[model samples]
Structures are given as structure tokens and as C-alpha cells.
Target: MDHLLGEVRAAGGVARVASLRARGHSRRTIENAVSSRALTRPRNGWVAMPGADPLLVAAARAGVVLTCHTQARRLGLWVLEERPVHVAAPPHRHVGEVKRDTHVHWARPLVPRHPDALVDPIENVLVIAAACLPREEALTIWEAALRLELVERWSFERMPLPSSARDVLAECSSHSDSGLETLIPVRLRFLRLPIRQQVWLAGHPVDFLIGDRLVLQIDGGHHVGAQRRSDIAHDARLTLMGFHVIRIDYVQVVTRWPEVHDVIVRAIAQGLHRAA
Candidate 1:
């Protein structure tokens, strides 16, 4: 009925027939609803209310569940790359049709997945991402997951992680302000420099304070308007106080990484990341 359509809409306009039945709609009611054009059976066991998420519908048709970076991005978790539809299937199940630009995973899942799930479990997604992505890149996503409480730190600790993955998690700080904040540590970790995060200075919390007097301010896409002006004022105050501030945006931190690296290296050579 009306409640059923609302549920369907809430569930991205599509749901498993079994789920509808479990929600107290009788089998006959479901059939009648479909017959009355109130719901449409998109697949053998799935019903959709007019317009479901096209991506999810396509994934369902392909019999592949979204996983790794793809699922992370969809869940609003931190992900460096966005292209290529990443999907996963159990080792025994046949995945979707082979196509260019489609990244399919056939590895056994670290966590159990429901038979009809259209998306991989969050833990599974992180595990796969940790193993597949560069250690530093993976750290941001894991840290973001931890910050959002989407996944518990203990859960990752309980999972069997390789030495490399363990190292990444060990450095994952829940205190990171954003994915870019997490990236600062990972990218600069190899330098063995003393780094502090979320440091309080002049009545504002800066993203990172490196060594002694250097601060890093990471700005995400929405870091504009009053916040941006306030940050600029803070930077001026910090500079006047003999603190070096390096402010960068998402693209400079995530995409133009080498440029960021060179800047950091030169700043270190100039002793900018240290006390005067």
C-alpha cells in the first residue's frame, strides 16, 4: 500500500520481495500490488517502485555487488579514485560480463556477505581496499571510516591483516579532520619527522603542526565562505606568530601529490617546518 511505496522509496526505490514480505506485506498483497502497477518486479525476486537507483539496478542485473573504493565512495567514505565500476563476487559465483573499465573482484570475502546483497559489507570493502590500494591512499579511507564510526577500530584489529596493512592502521588516527588531513601523515610518514595533528593555536584547531612551527591546513571542497575567510585570518595570525602555514585543497593534496611533496621537501630544507 502507501506504506509499502514509502518503504520502497526509502530503500532507493527497490527492494527484495522477501524484504517486503518480512515487512508484513502478504504474498497475495505483493502480487496484487504488482498487478495494480503499484510496484514492478524488476527481477525474479526483486521489486522496484518506478525509479530505483540506476547504478544499483544495473549492479543487481549484473549479479555483482559494489565493493572497495566504489562502495566506499557510494557510502561517502574517503576514496582517492572514482573511475571504473568496482564489483565483487564470491569465489564460487560467476560475476558480471567482462568489460573494459569494469574492475571485478573474485577474491573470497574477508567478511560473510548475504546471498542477495547488492553491496559488499563495509568491513569487507575496507579489507579489500586496504589490500588493493597503495598503503598511504588506503590509510585515509580507513581513518575516515573510523572517524565516522562506520567501522570500529577493534573490528579492523580483529581481522587478519598483512604486515603492510597493520602498519597503515597503526597510523590511522581517528582525530583526522578530513581525508586530506589523514593524507598529510601518510604522505609524510616516511620522513620520520615529528608530527602533531589537530593542534590548537590562536583559538583555532589547525589540521596539522609539523615538527615545531609548521602547520598544514587542508581544505575540502566545501571549505569556503565564512570558514574560508576565517581560515585565511588564522593563517595570517599564525604567520605573524612565527608559525609557517601551508594551505592546500583537495586536488593539490590528492591529485598533484608530487607537487605537494616537492613543496614539503623544499620547506623542510628551508627549515620552515621547525621552530625559529
Candidate 2:
């Protein structure tokens, strides 16, 4: 009985009764555990340990996997925005009924899903995300996945990904330090400047180096306390070395992008991006 509960805990606080049975637990053992209140049924044939994640329990109840942007954010990838919880229904199967606000992805997975799995793997998440999010927003998540080494690059090359997804994956660079690093260069590409990312200068990496002399630093949430001081010191050092520095925060890069864009344009017009 303890072993039965252990099985459920090892499976992320949830397990299918069939899966438990396959693991050598008999139906009577499962029933006894449930009868003793050691396990719970979120839905038919599914058992969850006490204090299971509500979202996973809900997914089990609905016979779906948490996927797309939801899973991407779960995996710590940078998501452009939050939306309704996204889930993927099993292929060719009805989900019966779910909340009307739940965004369901019905496309076949690029990777096969395990019957007992409650979350989509990174590959499936990326594929579904590509189909769901706008091109650039999806690219940010893809690049972050690569940068964090969540998914192997070889997977992208070999997976039978749709052309749209393939195109976005092709643009992904593992060197991007964050989603902002990915977003900055791609958005600035229209200027036809030689833009480089994660460039080493003054013994640290600048988020971006444009043309020959301009350094762009993007300050995410982590850029506070000691980190903020370090960045400010770096900006001063870059100035001493005859490089132009433009540092922007998360809100500036995301919400007030047009104003940030104008500043960069003005700096370029002054040849700040050029070596003197």
C-alpha cells in the first residue's frame, strides 16, 4: 500500500489506474488504497495523491495534456504574454466537455505522447506553440528553449515539423542569453546593421553589439541589486572604451518598444554604432 502511494508520488502525484496495474499493483490494491483515502480519482481510471497540483489534476480530469504556451512557461521559457490555460486533447478522441474558456490544441503531436503523461514534452510544446503564437513571439520561446538547453538542436532538424515551425526553429540561436536578446536583433534587422548577440566585452557579455561600437543591454527582472550595479559599471566602462551604450528594461523592450526603437534610430543616425 505504501508502495502504491509511492508509485503515484513518483509519477508526479498522479497516475493512471491502468498504469499502476501494469506496474504490478493489483486492482484490489488500487481499490483498497482509494477506499482508505490514500489516493483519489480525479476522473475515471486516474488516481492522484493528496495535494496534487490542481492544474495537472484538472488536466487528468479532462483527458488532456497541458501544452503550448502553458507548458512553455512551465519549462521556464520566456513567453511573450499569458493567455488562457492551453491544453492538447488526445488525437482523434473527444474530450467530452471542458470549460469553454480553455484553449484546446487539437493538432497531432510532433512527438508521441505517453498515455499516462500529463505534460507535453518540449518538442511537442514548441510545435504546438509555433502553430498557436505569432511568428516572432513563438521565436522568442524557441530561442529561450535552445539557450536553456531544454531541447536538443538535433530534435529540430529531424522532427517532421511544419514549414512554419521549421522556419522559426531555423532562426533560433542557443547563444541568446534571454528572450530579449533574441527579440532585439530580429526587430533591428530591418536596419541592415551588423547585429551580434552575447558579445564579450570588458570581461562580461553585452546583450547585443550593433555595427561596431554600440552595446545594447536588456535588463530583465534579475537585473537588480548587485546585478544592476554591475550593469551600470559595465555601461561606464563601455563609454570609456568609446562604445555607445543603450540599456533598456523589460517594460521598455516589451510595452514601449516604439520609443526604444526611436532611441536606437537616433543613436544610429549619430553614427554611435560605428567605430570612431
Candidate 3:
């Protein structure tokens, strides 16, 4: 029926037969619809509309939910790098079959997953990501989540996070404009110097204001054409205003960090971070 097709489409092009039944559809009706090719059985009890997301369909087939870093990336958070497809199997239950490229998370979820859900909630994504990734990499995603208002700081207090996750959360702040911005202050925290993020200066917001005068700008992929020109003009203006500027690109921040670190250190050694 058209109504049955609508229900499946509303559930992101996929629906569980049990859910359809709960919605007052009969088993015979569902079977008839499937028999007429109006819906597809992706797995035993799951029906997918035509052209459903292959990944979600695959997850349903595997009896898991797309989760962890994979879900974080899907949510537009700042992830350090791409990894294999990550999924969470129901705790204490055996997953039937999954793609070899899939990374399965078997940990108990901090938030309960709905039986018909194919994607993990943002909270579960962060907690699982924190446990799975390295300390700093996980912190990047956490800060992005905070910055984007996806999760509140106090919300995590009630959850049973492990020590490592707690440690990472302690370092997270919503002030970070991007994952790279988060990385900067965290890497320089050992200096015990005053650091601020997204500070207004020279009529624009700079990525970071270290100490009193140092302005650090991280240029991501979007810094091209008009944006790039504006950034350069702003750098000139900030320099004229007596603020030290160190503008680095994505590669320098992610791949060649030590070099960037040395530059910042040398600038500090010369008191570039201090007000004249």
C-alpha cells in the first residue's frame, strides 16, 4: 500500500516489519507489499525502500548500528582521520555477518539503542569514539561535539564514562572553532601560558590568541579564493596592529606538527607572544 511505502520512506528508507506491525499494519499486508515489490527485505525482518543507503542497509543486515568514529564523521564532527566502517552490535548478542572492512564495537552502550535504529545517537558516538581513538584524537571529536552544541558538558557527568574518557572531557571546551583549534591549545597547555580561542581582533575573529599578542590562524581546505584573500588581508592588518601571526595550513597542522611546534616555540622564545 502507498501508506506502507510512506512509513518505510519515513524511517530513512528502511523499516522493521515488527515496527510496521506496531503501526497497525498486518503481517499479510506487509507480505503482500513485499510480494508486490513495493518494499524489499534487506534482512530477515527489515524492509528497505528502493535506493536506501547501502551502509545502513548493510548495518541492518549485520544486526548492528552504525556508530563510533564512523557515525561521528557522518554527523560532521572533526575527526582526525578516516578509518574502517564502525558499527556497534547489541551488547551480549552475537552478530551474524558483517563486511570484513567493518570495525565492530561490542561495548555496552551508555545510551540504550532503539531496536529499529540504524545509527547511534551523538552521545553514544562520542563515548565510543573516546574509548576507541587515541587521547588527543578523541579529544578533537569531543571538542567539536561541544562546540557544535551536540552535547552539553554537564550531560556527561551522569554517564558512566571510563577514566580515559573523563580525562579527555576535562580538556574539551566548546570554544574551539575546529578540531585543529582544539589541538593547538591542548598541545600548548604544558607551557602554562594564557591561551584564548575565537578572540575578536583586527575587526575579525582569530583562531587563537595565545598569551597577549600571538594570533594563530589555521587555514583549512575552505581557505581558497575569496576566503584566502580575506585571511591574508586580515593577517596584514593584525601584523600592523602589533600582533604576532603564525598561519599554518591543514598539512602543517596534521602531518607536520613538530615543525609547527618549533615555530611557535621559537616565536615565544623571542617574546612574540607578549605585548610590546
Name the best candidate (by TM-score): 2
Best candidate, lDDT-wise? Answer: 2
- Model 3 TM-score relative to the real fold: 0.90
Worst 10 residues of 1 by lDDT: 91-100
RMSD of each: 2.8, 1.8, 2.1
lDDT (10s digit) by residue, model 1, range 159-260: 886665677778788678777787788778887898888889999998888899888888877778998899899999999999999888888986798998
Candidate 2: give its CA RMSD in angstroms: 1.8
Q: Give the per-residue lDDT of model 2 (tens digit) for 15-116.
A: 999999998999999999889999998898999988998878988999999998998988888998889999997668888466789999998888889999
Candidate 3's residue-wise lDDT over 1-276, tens digit each? 888899999999988899999999899988998898888888899998879988888888888999888988888888898789999976689886888888899978888999999999888888888889987889998988888889888988778888777888887877877888888887898878989988999789988888999988999889999999999999999989999999998899899999999999999999999998
The backbone clash count of each candidate, in order, is: 0, 0, 0
TM-score of each: 0.85, 0.92, 0.90
Report the Cα lDDT for residue 73, model 3.
87
lDDT of 2 at 182: 76
How many Å off is the CA of 239 in candidate 3?
2.5
Global lDDT of model 3: 0.88
